[model samples]
Target: MSRALKATAIRLTSASALAVTVLTAVGAAPASASTLTDGISATARAENGNGACAHGGYVGGPNQSSSCYGGTTTAHAWCADFAGWVWARNGVTGLSTLDDRAASFMDYGKKYGTISNTPHVGDAVVYNYNGSDYADHVALVTAVSGGTVTITGGNQGARPGHVSTNATSSYSVGSLPWGQRISGYVSPAGSNTPSLPNPASLPAGTLVKSPNGPDVKVIINGAGIPVAASDVTPDKYDLSKIVLVDDTAFRALPSAPASGTVVHDQAGGANRYVVIDGTALLIGAEDWTAAGYNDRADMGVPTAWLQNAAQRQLTTGIVVMDQTGKDPKRYVMVDGAALYISGSEWTADEYNTQTLMGVPGEWLKAAAKKVPSTGTVLMDQSGTDPSRYVMLNGAAVHISAAEWTANGYDKRSLMGVPGGWLASTVSAQVSNGTIVKDASGANATVYVMAGGVAVPLSYADFTGFGYDKRPLEGAPGEWLVSAAAKAAPADGTMLLSPDSNTVWQVVGGKKKAMTADQFGEGKLSFNDVVGVPTAFTAKFPTV
Candidate 1:
């Protein structure tokens, strides 16, 4: 019977940190890995023409090294050393030689398991080809094919100590002369040896169960993952069982991540799909870029369109790309599923106006009834006027008497700003800090609390990911960056910075844009910033 052996190899090394990747195989007993060492020693012994020395023990010579093929009257071939190790593992004390090891395998008693469809654990995986007339490199079988014989190994590299998903064809086998002759196989003993565990089990051919996770998520590759509820497995469908999007009741699902979508390519091709609120938006393979998507500019029509459609269908937040200098704007598939136009220069107003709130204030008022209203309204500018503002508890706040707030304002707070204003915005019952941008990507702020009291932040030292110490300087009306937020340190010192991008944090000698994740070792991207361009320079007077 034709068998499919999905074996993996792993090489080990002692010099540097090892790169570790895991592979899982089901069923199938593995072949003995030590056989490779045995084969190496036996080959050396045969080449040296050492007679009884071929018994496979530590037969050393003039300048010997410790290996299964011990005699190093010549330069040591690390490959031979590996072969010797296998022999040593086999309990052959003195007959240490590659030739001896191979010869020993030829002997009746010590040979390992035989190779076949029913391969068991600890069998030597061998292959025959080329003029070499014998098996060369070897690895222990960890998993078998069909409930039995199969192949796989890792850690096979030039150093032989490296681990990999499969045997190294060049170094493992090709390193020796005549390394490619199939001479059957052998299994090793003693491994009640604990093996690595496989990852979560997946029933074969199962896909798209139900909604459960991120509101809109997608998976392009499912190699290591099991079939989950939030996926669409068109690739695995049989002709009779195929279901089209129109035929399914996907729209009836809630807009939760659990109802997210998964797309697969079964036309022996790669395609893209977007997951938006449980449904998929397929861009197909064409017209994606023609419709202004430059990310897949060069992809074939079918592939590109499939990806574009996915992006369009996403209901997730947008990710604006910077496309100032490039001919065409590019798109990034955020959350690994939805593609958004990327590389485009953005601004506070641009970012704000892009949201649903950016619609006309009249439109907002018309839809105001749709959103839920909390009874206790905290007015931020309450001190201004009871008719205009109302202080809920501590922070002075502003609330609109009308069902909806004015243009460019949210129903209960500022229109574009959600989570409320940083300072005047109440936290539980108290107000302590101001709103600010946390990073280059998004604007988020936090309020400072001390001794259980909301301590108002000031303009001295604000701590965050990136830092720009440049003071706010420019024509006032020209729009210097706004003060993002103010925070009073535990020491009573006030911290401050413009609301746009920079937050004061020190790295190496200079204070520049820095993120907490990066261990203050590298330079920030802004170091390359030339002066603001003449066109936009007026708008960013304080930058």
Candidate 2:
């Protein structure tokens, strides 16, 4: 609906969010990113229409020059070429050697460590729809809708090879079954802007001097951020917009940013100051901040606690967002039915304190114990501890731990299963083991192991599914047959009786009874069923 609502609902993905942020920035490119464009002026290039690239023209056989960008030829896929030309025309630096292949943008971004999922307004959207590690197409990120990124590209639709605004591709930001057709994003090549964020995102009582012509002023306050309250009037900017915090005792207001200048605070960490365009009053609570949580209004709606916080904070440990209550609490996330605890932040001292918070740590350990002791053991290569090793469409990738809490983080992608479902192998402790049948011969008892732990099957299910059962007065402990243990057992398995004389072996993938004559005295001592060996000839001495 509204632009502010849309922005608040979702965030722009990082074309380069992994790089550690600088304390002070005037919107300059990160150390890990090269400039692609400083944003286009459209000079004579209209936003859309037949004359999209009017001022630019083509000459020789469509080289990396400005001609190929808006050239009259559609000989090759020039999405990347047009993007490069746009960046070059806008006076961005460091892209003189940009290639025509759509994947080269990724190479440039990786070289500078800026290739990320977050897309800016002028980045190249790389795609891998064909399953290639290399991107198949490239487009420009022109807008972000909710959690979807919309971008424009070349060689698409009827206007082959023109800079068009409507040419778009979408990638999901904060959703499950997460991710877009997008491979990643590449920033523009150069131009060292001071890395300043929009001055409007600062807290109340922050004094800001508007940019005087093109001159910008950057000042780091004590908090390391360029935050201040103003009561100053100069050649430019209205000081009235600055929040006033007058002590009143001295009858004076706070000082203003020097020279009415737009400032970049060096105190704030990289990516520490994201623009929150929401209407709710969320404080920067430490736990919520670490978990990348949105603040709750002092007594605001509780469900509003961690909207879109699933991915980023999910990296390090188990992050359980107890969305069950009105105000959802946070907990460590775990696999196996998505176990979640209900609470806020925890520190190193409170580590392993699930019991303290009324969580059954023992229960989680049960599942974790079954998984590979270390995720590395499950990985093709384990260089270090990663955020999570995702198995997507059967392809496993190790996401970096450094970005455990970055935006667009989806766990099911890493888990390789749909939400609310877990990957598990239900195995009976004992297979092809001894079983006691009823006197009426209508039912059988299935023991879990050698020690006779009865197979714990749901009775309604045990009888409803037609496992061996009888019309007894009470449920029998002598489980002769398994109901749940062999729902869809693999071919060639064994089913035997506790008597040790009656033997049944799977033949040609079907269970067949062994002749009693075959297991008398010196006959075959063992019979194989479903890949398990059962001692049928040896008399099972009954107590």
Candidate 3:
């Protein structure tokens, strides 16, 4: 209803006060004797046509009056304000603890022990409550019939800033919009609470289902784990403990269940699997007891879900070995592959401090014997040789100690490989954009790798182009001496002389001076400019 029409109705009601008084004098119940629910309903209905609820823009507008905003001209999100006003007018206590935020109503209910899952007349329904401290909206539940609830709320229209009318909406029980759900229902302080289970207080391992779907999930470590319907049995799981929640609250939980949970196929299959680091690993029937998993419950899940989860490999940094002691080798997972961990390296990297998960011998056999992922730092721990190398381009490149510290390689986790892998000749060169200098020579020159050749960088260029801030890795002196040398920057490289304002774009082996307008027209940024020595820029002819 529009506020203009409501004003006319108010005027007509005022003119009929005498007639109403005469009728009440006979047998009608007076307004003062109305119940709390009736009072809340009447107050909310009377506010429908008051004015458009405004957040801030409607300072002096009809909605931003003293009645709701404490006489201040500034308007705020007033849905809570309107609700609080109606509650306080009806003499509901705890208005002092209430605020303008919708979440405060949930807090109020908890403090008063009046929060529940079932809705009742005069209850405040909170939407999008994530169990901690967030809720999107709140409204007064004016009616609760079979499978449906009717609510009236202020600031309820589509337009946020200038919503004009208090609105009423009806939703079938547990059927709120996506990403929004009734988190809880808060009744008035002294009302008799319903006997439904409160999801917030439910313990871990409790089963829960969303009203939107038929799937049931068990709560593990605050995450939802899907359980097949066939797996839900009377002896295994208590069906009566399943709490019904909305989709938003269900999805807000962690997607994957906790690690170390055992599971099997829904149809009572013989194959069993254990979840570790979000991946499911098959546990052989013979090895299950040896792996210390004989007592764990093997929960049944959908077959397709188990297969999809098995596709993910165990996460890196987990240490694992065979439980039967057949291989007697410990390996650390990296990029879905296992790299054998030498005894010395294991102690140095503190792998001994981590828990070692035991798997079947076949799983260990399949994961072993693969090269460590590229960029892994490796060292030969079998002998006294102190050489350290970096795996790049499928080969090891020798890196000196000075380079290791300068490039922050010392901070990376070092994996020990067999001495045979490090004895092979260096086949990979330093990649482009890497800064290198010969550490064996006195006052060695700093160079940047370009086109597989080392190009000397002047001190001014090194600092001006911001290359000094990058890690300077040391290459073998013999390798740098034999490598080709480049006199000019690579073609298509953008260069800027340290002393000049002109920006040069290298094209077709020539330097082309770019104007300010041309640089802007080409959508080029000065941040891409590489400061280089004037002598290097002079090698390219101006075109």
Candidate 4:
């Protein structure tokens, strides 16, 4: 027997007992009795045994093998499958294009030109669709009573993954279960689509209200976000654009405002928030000007809206601190993380010159502290420590006074950092590519650094290699003694014989002759060739 006939037989055998149960579940009996010709609504009702079907499992439940599962070997999220099966059984065209994903119904509706915001009996309701992906859920609309939409879907029980009727899972017309909003409704192909207000048709920032309620909302991104009457100011919102809409039309719009909107509580509070990805993050008073939020108009929102919005750390690069003065430490926000900056360092880096945003003490305390970005020059300002350092690959490397002066680092601004962080740095040799000679040693030999080793340069080679044009840093006598072992010029160094036009490219400690053609192909320029005495060029073997 067909499933619909079986449902009828069951009802006929126990009509008295089932009638009371159905009435209690539905609050009132449906407008019409169940029949095979009733379309998808009848098929949906029969499959769930009129809200009596339950197996107590999310997957592999007794309903897994039911018609709602679409005969799959393993149970999956079956809400879409159930809706699709009901529509197909009721002779809806374009069922072949439907899939097990809730979003597929939306695609089918759009392809068949049957998708709209209005709900109708036998239409499929899609929830939480963000465009180009599977929606959260789907259900068959069994009834569209005033202010309420009754739907029958699978995997929707308290335990989930079970077939059920609208009697167990009905919702207000505009909202869905679990805080989800209806993305759209999809009617069967060739069916007469219902007419409804399109929120997208309204211009953003227009003030609107429902005739049934005095509460007003501002339209933003196709959604009506409630704004407190007292909070609406003529300076930010135009009073003439406020329009009254029917309750149903008003409810059809989504409730959340778009990101970057500035909002404050309508009930009158000093607290303000900025919407980001649908959540409101608190913006302290000091941050309003520093973060440039003054540029955005402030909207008064319902108190409930602020209460429901979850707070997260602000993702910005602004400088922030505690306004209470209890914690005088200031921090720079780097990708949502905070890096504490000392007072001296703050002034030296000119952060003191910029506007500082003061946030709540509790929020500043909760922020995660991270290291400063690389390339920052830091010096320990404490009278006990005199070491200066530079940030490299996340760690601080010590820079000697001689090297600092030789490199003209005295001209660069120094950030005063905590002595504790400075103690973590290692007193290592100067970085590669630096020209160095002993600061106090009698040896006047100058060397160019290459991978921590020093390669000696003659007076002629120094000027020829263009090293004379660059800053020659001074190194400690101890470091120079260890690093100044006799070695050839660094690999890739182009050498020119002092008395001849011969040019050689250094490779693996050997010199390779370069032809005119080879030099042009390699993009070698005569300016880069270092002129060395015949004895220096003759030391390395020719390759």
Best by lDDT: 3
> Which residue ranges in model 2 land beyond 4 Å of their true spot?
1-38, 41-47, 50-53, 56-72, 129-134, 159-161, 167-169, 173-180, 192-543
Cα lDDT listed for each candidate: 0.28, 0.35, 0.60, 0.59
Better of 1 and 4 by lDDT: 4
Write one digit per residue (lDDT tens) for candidate 3, span 361-418: 6667777755555567777645545878776534567676666876666878886654
Deviation of model 4 at 394, angstroms: 19
- Over the stretch 80-143, how does candidate 2's per-residue lDDT look in tens digits? 6656655554454566445666666665665555555566666666654222224445666665
TM-score for predicted model 2 compared with the true structure: 0.26
Worst 10 residues of 3 by lDDT: 17-26
Model 3 / residue 148 / CA error / Å? 35
Better of 2 and 3 by lDDT: 3
Runs with alpha carbons beyond 4 Å of true place in candidate 4: 1-194, 201-218, 221-256, 314-543
TM per model?
0.24, 0.26, 0.39, 0.28
Per-candidate clash tally = 116, 47, 2, 2
Per-residue lDDT of candidate 1, residues 1-543 (tens digit): 001111111111212432221112223333343433333223322233222122343333222343323432212222223333333433433332133122232221132222232234444444331112222234333443343332332213343122223322222221221233333344433322222112112222322221111122111222122222223334333333322211012223222222223343333355443333433434333423432333521211122224344344333244322222222332222222212222222232243245321111221222222221222233212222233333322332333344223222233342122222323233322222322222222222222322112222233333342223332211111010222222212222112234444333322222334344543348333332222112221222231
Alpha-carbon lDDT of model 2: 0.35
Better of 3 and 4 by TM-score: 3
Ranking by lDDT: 3, 4, 2, 1
RMSD of 1: 24.1
